[model samples]
Target chain A: MTTATDKSAANSETTAGQWIRMYRQMVSVRLFEEQVNELYTRALMPGLAHLYIGEEAVAVGVCETLRADDYITSTHRGHGHCLAKGASPDRMFAELLGKEAGYCKGKGGSMHIADPATGNLGANAIVAGSVGIATGAALSAKRLGKDNVAVCFFGEGALGQGVLYEVMNVASLWKLPVIYVCENNLYTEYTHFSETTAGDIPARAAAFGLQAESVDGQDVRAVYATAGRLIDRARREGGPSFLVCNTYRYTGHHVGDINREYYRSKEEEKHWKTERDPLKLLADWLVAQGLADSTQFKRIQSEVEAEMKKAVEFAVAAPYPSVSEAGEDVYA
Target chain B: MLETLTRELTFGQAVREALAEEMRRDPRVCIFGEDVAEAGTPFKVLSGLVEEFGTERVLDTPISEAGFTGIAVGAAMTGLRPIVDIMFGDFITLTMDQMVNQAAKVHYMSGGAWKVPMVMRTTLGATRRSGAQHSQSLHAWFSHVPGLKVVMPSTPYDAKGLLKTAIRDENPVVFFEDKMMYTKLKGPVPTEEYTIPFGVADVKRVGRDITLVATSSMVQVALGAADLLEETGMSAEVVDPRTMWPLDEKTLIESAKKTSRVIVIDEGYERYGVTAEIAAVIAEGAFYNLDAPVKRMGAMHIPIPFSPPLEDATVPTEKSVFEVARKLCGQA
Candidate 1:
């Protein structure tokens, strides 16, 4: 529904210069995921590596509306969210490599990367666990009379968690300034949405009397616009909002595991890839409007790739925690 | 300054005074719990704080233990030194995941980048007419967690000093107060600033026949039992491990070496509790110094009953501690 004339509408609040920066961030996250998937295939990354190849818009769009001091809680599939929140790509890659220079000093691997300085509370492996944490953080902000808002990034499957309801009830009851951004990527791992979820996801949040909406997750500008409105309302009126972004994943649930044999069909995958490729759609729009050229985009991609490589090198060379450190950080 | 002040204040009053003093001293320190506002807590330890500091600082929350406790964790993580009151210690079971996983692990998981500088003031004894849900001592449950610091004060002086230390401590401290000793006990507490560091054992009574290690309410019972043992010509050395997690093992082992026999007493159940931990340590460290098997006196391995007599029977008494000490000393 967005036309060429309406591009000015999106650009009215933010300059094209800011949009370029946002594009670079989104591209950087997408490239990072591609590299992570390649590393996983090469057996360099351990455990599970949940790819964010298709959900880049949700992370990028929501985070683009937040301040660096604003807190965020990420889900198990959280590398994109961490990157969009400004965690160093090299530190993140180092963590994925299980090396010493990782964001968590190699203790918290890919799923748990966090930078407290950046107000990232750490990603949790448990489903819906971050909901309560972000809600609590919002309460802290409210009590301190700070306008800072907290954003909780979770998957669609987290709708079933009892704690999620508890968090929503409290957040709405107190009218805490929190934004609940659900990246509803059509599946909870290999299971389809129809198999697990019941009723509307946004309706569940609306039942708690919170402002709720369902957005096109693949559209970065749409997600950013919706998130910006909700975030502005939260900041102005001191209330909470819930927004669900409907998207799809381009690969298996995790790296090296082909999910096509189990749940989804190839035709379904091809359909989403062609119709809802977020990056390709954004790139095409930018080029058609003369906002950017293929040469500039390629230059950005090369810069991102070079930065990621340097990050890998730093993490690989970083020293692991000394054995004496086993007892040091357990306390203050 | 500490020696001049003489008052007959209970351990509960000392705790309330400590919290009041800390909140008055540091604007960052605040207290919140059910009935902590007007009903003055179930144990009445937080009496008058809500009136003194106003509802903003001394808050009364709904029976959402996990929610509010989780809020305290976030508040502490963000630089607020919250003195959270969980009315009954047994109620902590409902919030174990937040307390053990989130509060305890936040500091260590962040690799010391963030410190959960907070105090959870709770009570854990079974002398009241309250039922099983309200009456249980589960300090061992918290002590088992790696990153948490557990503290329990047995006397009025230690309650004041140790609570002060716990409030100022940079780690998440689970401060357990014995409900039984709230009113019946009294001691000389300093009006000025004072602190008892963790891992220091207070020698309640020094004897030679046996070493008796007791925690919280059990410490007072052990002292009473030591009196009875002395009357029976069995000299028992009473050692109170003020803080449970960073245990005062050095003092305990030294007492065990002097007495050559040991009896560990606790108000919690026998299996895998603090009593068991102390007994195991003595067995491992003082195996050669022991004259007989190390004995443990603790509550029966069942929930505390509602009946006054049954509850009294289930809890470890002075007679039980005395009998264990006598048996360990080979005098009965």
Candidate 2:
């Protein structure tokens, strides 16, 4: 890996190793979801799981720029967040599989995998649920005089959530070290983003006095660059920033939502999957830059596949918490 | 007798004192909600907090209930303890995602890895003609959640003590105060610091003929009914389940056994509401001791009307409760 003298985002020096690692992380997330999908289809998993298949760059790119001590609050589609923010694959697998050793002791499952040690506050099923949580965490960091920032990850659908705006307003008002990252995947769920949302999102946050950035969410480098600048500025008490990443999801809203012919056309899905897949873009960019070849990419895929197999196996073998355990976590 | 040793304060003033005392005692504690900072809240429960703690600590948030509530959740999960004042109880519906999905479930979802030691204070009432949204007694909805604690303070003493306790509590606490009673529900609060623990029922008046279980503002109504009952042959015990979720089932059941009859009163709707829970508890625990069918008095299953007479007709009043008790005790 090549090093910049200042280790700053402004130092746009290319590093073969860093891109390769980022690609590997994205691939692992993809492979992990594929395994989950296969198991879910096979009735090996009981509950529904929201897959983070296509929006890989948004999580990997933004999270990679964050320090280990910085925090993130994720949405229901948060598997990629857990992977990118350093959650173990097997534990998350166990949780999604309803095993006790998993994050949240399998009590939370896919929609709620919190890794406090890594500052992942868990994924919320409610739209814009973590908007406040993330901002509050940033407020806490600022109050405690820590340099760490808290990022809130929500979809374009969350733009309709009033709380998102509320948190965004005071986040900038108090000059809280928070970042609002909206992965505008062009769809809230079955509906197109344009159908429900009006006005520019970044501009909306900017109106709240936030330093706003709009970027191509499919391009990992782009997300990384913008997030880097915003996060760095926030750490130095530059207040909050909002980054709207224009992206797309390859699959339906939830795993159970397979048939989308009613609200969406197959061509739109194909356009994104074939032309703008974050994984494919990253892989191609890496290969184009001579960072890794097809053979290296294949090798990474195989390794991730193996890891996913082991993780699924562990999840399958892990036992569910006893019925008595159900009553335990309700209080401190 | 114990009330005589305390200083008398308005319900709103008692709440203000609690916020001030808590903020003074712990730097981690801060207050936020709509108009809470400079205006001191619509009900003035947080009057002078901004002057005392400064605008930074006593925050006046953008009218975003979901945002501030979730931010409070995140802040509490981290190092800071936050008290979120929802301007009106009706506005709570806007922030249900944060309160129920994030604040209520974080500790449980995180497998006890974290705690949301936050307090959400709101005002609920009917006769003021605040319309449907501003006049809901939605405590039953919160009580349904497993991880969150629900507190309803009917008097100034309970307001001060319980707010202090809720602030110190390690779990998320939803504090519901009746707006109509903020100025009217005056009582003596100790000048010195004191706290009231949850799940404890306060037996406001002792009687033998019947147990009248009430919540929040309804405690005063039930007390009024009991006073009228005293003029007749019937003796009705007034029991205020100060906190319903951690409901003192023991006290309620004990009272049921003593009185051999129960009348549960709530300002919320009668269907599937707090009254239902109380009746179910008595049935489950004191079925053999019942002299008559346990009765419930709650708001009629209709949206709170804006007209004063119509609104009063929807909610439970002293006359309504007294009539029900009179009939149950064979005094009608």
Candidate 3:
């Protein structure tokens, strides 16, 4: 088992194109979340918004290794996972705005956005709720002789849930093709994780005989390298692995939760935002390596900003689902 | 009617036959749960399944109900149709978040993009001295959810037919089998294949004086009560709404209108149980034709005890149902 501070293996084989694409994806998620916070502040979005602003690298790096047909189950703070898994921004904004053109046709809203075309099982609102679904998908892949692997993305808060341990044990025993990705963003909604979680996190998976590893979540290359190794092993019948990504949440638990002095301090948030930001770290590496310049980074940001602006406009102009449709999809 | 050979089969055998036949027809169908493979689930309901389907399909998982149940949801959204075998209904509390928050809401929340074609098979009823932890008829809990279908079978024939439909359905269905009736109850099951559609009521016995609307284990008790009422120079109709969520409201209302009185019975708790929902539906649909207020019979509000006498006293019996029917008909 690897510790939280353990550095990931070397990523010398990754080409410039893949690195730039990963950078663009992370930037897309950040811009999308910035727009979501804008929607919430303007009272355009109906439900709560749990933005994935600071933890973009974990989703982008891990999902970058997956094929379009591979399955994934996400958590409540899941816009980043959805986008990284290939969900369209226009439809996602429509869903958050409770419009008929949304991913869930306005039924699921922020906490639940699922798409079969992209093999997203759906973003679950309950903590650690989708662990079993990801494991089951792996079981289906194995039994059906398909080489697809499933990725389950959850927060450290899910460690408090007993089902996570149960599934991890069974996944190890059955040798299912799945990965348990725990994004330890430190705070589990108003309290530090240490106050709630006891014992070592990686040791929990190791006890179940799973291949447990940890990586610096702010480093997209580290996340991509570690997740790629585990996912490939799983596809080749290596069973499940638990990957703990040490990340941070730059925003409050939700958009409405603005006060932060009660749980965390301004210095802590400032240090992570300025020094350890995922986008800034990746950009610095790209610049030093002579692979990209400041001009290319600026172009990427402007492109993403334009795309997000259009998506929000489409969502605001889209119609709400008719009252008759409220009872339509309840059965099949 | 099509000519088909019929033979008496126990409830357990019928359920096993349904699983075996479905797994054979669809290569994607599989079963997983604690002691499901070789142990055949303590009751020996699935004894020969592992031998036929092999261990790959008939998997034996850890005692992690929530974990495996969540996996079933994910697998169902993908390519495979999974049957999750929960040992007892009392343990459903562990899997509620996976079922309610994940499985039940996935399809509708995804805007009908994904389907959870899965079945959760578990046991209900008491009187085996299994104590409070092992005995419970909690089908009503699943039925209360919008996106889940709840099935309760009384006879071997109904069990086989309904279980087949549940496995083939394109949504999450909770199939509750009365454990006490596994071997004790026998009925003629057809050798040829067939499926009983949801939301259709079965008229177990036809009468004109009063109606006894029952579900699952209570259906058998209702039949016995109808027999007693026949001896007392009264006619009591018995109607079984096999699936509770997609309830046969039209059939139940028709029966209530014809009989002018009704007594709803189930094996779940009396307060806020299946009986209450069915009674409400009948009252709303047949208010003008009814002669008396609808009565409900179910398990006592306390936990089922370990003692045989106390356990038996908690649930409704043939005598109690008969007395209630008699009183409703103004003959008490």
Flag clash pairs in model 2.
A132-B71
Compute each candidate's TM-score over C-alphas: 0.94, 0.92, 0.96
Candidate 1 per-residue lDDT over residues A1-332, each given as its tens digit? 22222332353566656566777888888888888888888887889999888888899888888877788989778998999888889889888877667777677788877788788988888787667678777877877878778899999988877767776777887788889998899889888988899987899999989999989998888888888878777777549999999999888888866747578889988988898878777778778878888898798888988988887777667777667766777887
Q: What is the interface RMSD of candidate 3, in Å?
A: 1.0
Report the number of backbone clashes for model 3: 3
DockQ for every model comes to: 0.52, 0.68, 0.82
Residue range A1-332, candidate 2, lDDT tens digits = 22212334622753777778888899988888888888888988878878888889889888878877889999889999989999989999999988899999988888889999889988888888788889999999998889889988999998997777778888878899998999988778888888998877778998989999899999988887788788888888889999999888888888789899888889988998999988789888877877778999889988988888898888899999988898888898
State which candidate has the highest lDDT: 3
Deviating ranges (above 4 Å) for candidate 2: A1-7, A10-14, A199-201, A252-299, B1-5, B129-133
What lDDT would each prediction earn against the true structure?
0.82, 0.87, 0.91
- Return the TM-score for candidate 3, rounded to 2 decimals: 0.96
Better of 2 and 3 by lDDT: 3
Tell me the interface RMSD of model 1, in angstroms. Answer: 1.7
Q: Interface RMSD of the predictions, in order shown?
A: 1.7, 1.0, 1.0
| Residue ranges of candidate 3 with Cα displaced over 4 Å | A1-10, B1-3
